[model samples]
Target: MTQSMATRATVTVAAELTDRCDRCGAAGKVKIGLAGGGELTFCGHHANRFADGIGTAAERVVVESGFGWKGAQPI
Candidate 1:
């Protein structure tokens, strides 16, 4: 089932994305906190493209405010 916005709020949402994308050195928009304890940050483009896979494995997701992320839902 899809998660509601309220439930999604549990994940950290930053005002601005300051990190560079791990895949490509672009402005990061999404941050995926791994279940095992690390994190991966991504730009909007890469994040959406890999959303499905990342969503399933992430522990917590932190997206830039106002940035629409395909993998915003909690697994």
Candidate 2:
């Protein structure tokens, strides 16, 4: 059977909670708003490890785009 829109929405909301990877800080496709009001963006690793911890500690952890930490660009 097909899922209803309401069900999908609920699933979406739940999925949002599992976005980023806490360990490596990998940002996922969707960006979610945190409880405290801040933002957090992780890649994949970091989010998984500390997702719960970070979420509780801060409001949000926004994921950053572009170059590396050292600000180095590829040739």
Model number with the top TM-score:
1
TM-score of each: 0.79, 0.32
How many clashing residue pairs are found in candidate 2? Answer: 31
The C-alpha lDDT values of all candidates are 0.79, 0.37
Give the number of the best model, judged by lDDT.
1
Q: Give the least accurate 10-residue stretch of model 1, judged by summed lDDT.
A: 1-10
List model 2 lDDT by residue over 1-75, tens digit each. 342211111012123434564335454632334564655555544543443444345443333343121111112
lDDT of 1 by residue, 1-75 (tens): 564333322367899988999999999999888878888999999988887767677878898999988666535
Model 2 lDDT at residue 57: 54
